[model samples]
Target: MGRPSDIPVWRHIGEAPCPPSGQERVTIAIVGAGPVGLAMALEFGRRGHQVLLLNRPDFISAGSKAICFSKRSLDIFDRLGVGDAIVEKGVSWNVGKVFWGDRPDPVYQFDMLPVKEQKRPGFLNIPQYHVEDILFDAASTLSSIDMRFGHEVTNVLPDDDGVDLEVRTSLNSYKVRADWVIACDGSRSPIRSMLGLEFEGRIFEDNFLIADIRMKGDHPSERWFWFDPPFNPGQSALMHKQPDDIWRLDFQLGWNIDRKAAVAPENVEPLVRAMLGPDVEFSREWYSIYTFQCRRIERFLHGHVIFAGDSAHLVSPFGARGCNGGFADIDNLGWKLDLILRGEAPASFLETYDEEAIVTADENIRNSTRSTDFITPKSETSRAFRDAVLELAQDFPFARPFVNSGRLSTAISYPDSGINTPDMDRWVGGVAPGSPVIDVPIGNRWLLDRLGNRFVVLADGWQGPAPDGVEIIDVGIAAETLQLIRRRFDFSPGAACLIRPDQYVAARWRTPTPALVSDALRRARGLA
Candidate 1:
């Protein structure tokens, strides 16, 4: 019942401040202990930099916020040694079904996506807590990372040297200084607002209510998008399976209804009963009313104070990109901050964090917006077009992509991003300049499965030895895997590609050319 901050550190992962007697200075102070902040804290600590991770409420959120994670995000988590536990507990779902208005069954069930080759986990549907628990545990293992919860960041004052943060505990307040400060706060970020960064975007008129309920209904295990639930005349609903036999259902409640009244338990039950039928047993796990808003800060990093996750941008939860997008932010910013703090790379490397991340965040915002547009069309004419397309898509393969506008497998790429080769051909699949996630086999293993750690170059017909500092796996994969790579990746027999550490295509060539390969690796390392 006493101050939570008064608790000793070793007793628990308490938010008590490190005694101010030493006035300990650190390289970076990361604000917010959500997934993004925790990821950054781990990355910086791994680089041997002093880090202070601050968060409030002193606990992991119990509700499951995120619905899906991408293969690339899984790979990053693998490197950090946290993705394994999450992979074990969460369900792996690669397929999704799309339904039309009042349709008894889905018209299109998409199951085609390139699988990662490593024994590491592929796409997963673990709740946000599972990821946070792993990350929090990993952060605790690091002596360099001081995980402080219950420390409310009351102020962030930035300067040319570094930022000064005022963190208030129940006992007292402490002033902490660091060379860098990262704000991983959510959409209504105080740090971002203090910097005067404009969050530019509009909100969709439609509102929705989401409830996690246990239902033994007729729904498939895969992700489901009902274009128009019969009970909701002009709206849509998304229902998907989760761990522990729970199902997440999101229903559009229309703009005419009051946001406050729409989320009442009494108001929500009818929608669920109508969709799942009266015979099914149901119990609520959690519920929330949500509105679609798409916005991105103009810059991710302002001076020495940086931003990540919802602090940088806010995307609708339609594509399961909201939290995963923030995870990507940490993955990108982590290594860059590591390099800068270790003096391996100039702080200029940090600049690319803003450039590359903002681009990806903006793209995510746009993609989420597109999904919202499909879910809630603005005009009657647009609705008619969507209806017509849904009808046509019932039988046509070409119209399926139009009706299913969201591309879930789209990997994060920065073609003009200082990290990649400007001339690399992006036509082939796999994580190329413009490539989405595609299946490629390495020996008997899949290319995506085996791609972890350093950059990799999977060359089938190398006339010469592989380039220096590149892992050239010519025969590490099965012949079938190689054949799969050729068929799906469209690689020529002698084809070669330079994959970045993050598993994105840095450069590619029909043949293993030394100069291009070397330059691509160098660029990926940011030496260029």
Candidate 2:
């Protein structure tokens, strides 16, 4: 056994877990080195906690899965130190066109970011591998994060205090003790199975083909989805542009087709040519046939061990919710975990993580299930209804809401979150309490840049000293930014908002007293 050459920080198979006095005992041990786990490690590290990342494979995830990153994910990456690079390397797109039948034009087009003033784009199209590399590189530089590739978790023993993990590397085994173990394992979760947990939901009958090809073409930087196109008739198709002149094209193949033949070169070649025109030249980079399932464990937390990302829940890839939702899990859990570890919050706080995150999961699964039904009609009556909706969507504005082209991923809001202290004043046409704070520009700096990763007070014309532990925004430096803030928050002279560490609104007031802010902070921290 020897130290891994790739990562200088960790011993792949050379040594077992450190002794009681050994330096390897970490505050958090995250299983799975995928993007979610990597970000999870970085998040804890950023909050001044030590994390050990166990990656089963040697960082070789195939097929560029989960290409689209949403704004919430990008915003999180900004704090993690990889946002600018990803935005520069990926194709930034906000417009989506949905085409139905043989129309050379779309039935109707939608814009993901109608605001046009946010710091990040509505979506960034880049290979998931690129995101992993960037996140890993960032995590490696931090002294608090130790990433071990090629390490598998063979056994897990949980107790009232913490969990003991048995990790198996290529040629050796090690036992590690962690105060907390967060499993970011993929859908076929070994951690979930090892714990005797199961995901309860339906598995859709239809299958889809993913053809990722490299080519040079004039395709605009936008998302295009087609229903029953001439090339791929009687089925749905989606097209997206990625970095390095790569394109992702997905075709819905009905149930009962030969999975092997569907991905064959001869069969895939015709589909690509038909969609991209007869004279288009391209080479296949990767081909995959996938059957999607929408399922989630009834509970995400099992005492000291918690499941996250694809391990806890899975949704059809239609809404790009797969990765974005995982990022959401990291954002919600990191601060709470940090607080609980520092003895700043009660262990009961983690229950809110279970409740809030499940809210997000249920939202994503419901949309994924509906999108699957619309894209792949199971019955003739369903097919007719889908067609009629699309036809009307082309001409009628109201019908457009019925047209569901895999409704793109967006950040989730917990309107009824346990942490929220309801509005003390009437509000309308603004970001709601318990929803994520809207991103805006204030003078030369973005609002999110000012927010950082801490609990804060966003004040507009409030005349009071800053509360203890909570930072005050005191914004509106520039004239335009001031106006934008006032409109976005619907504020008066003494207006203020209490925002949680994850940039979620906890409470707001048209006018506030010092006692109210303190109570809100305590409640948001799960102490009240």
TM-scores for every candidate against the unseen true structure: 0.88, 0.95
The global Cα lDDT (0 to 1) of model 2 is 0.86
TM-score of model 1 relative to the true fold? 0.88
TM-score of 2: 0.95
User: Candidate 1: where are CA atoms >4 Å away?
Assistant: 1-14, 112-122, 216-219, 424-451, 456-480, 486-495, 510-516
Q: Write the per-residue lDDT of candidate 2 for residues 1-528, one digit (tens) a residue.
A: 243354323212223342343324567999988889988998998777889888776544656489999988999999777899889899999999999879998886888887868899999999888888788778878998887777788998899999999887667677888989999988988989999997899989988999999999889999999999999999999999999989999999889999999999999989999999999999998888989899999998899998889998999998899999999998999999888998989999999999999999999999989988998887999989999999898789989878888778888999998889988689886777789988999888899888998999898877556578777878756467788888887776788998988899898888877888888888999999
For model 1 the local lDDT of residue 393 reads 84
Worst 10 residues of 2 by lDDT: 7-16
Per-model CA lDDT versus the true structure: 0.73, 0.86
Model 2 segments more than 4 A misplaced: 1-24
Query: For model 1, how does the per-residue alpha-carbon lDDT over 344-428 read when each residue is reduced to its tens digit?
Result: 5677777888888887887888788887777777789977887888888878878787875455634567767877676545454
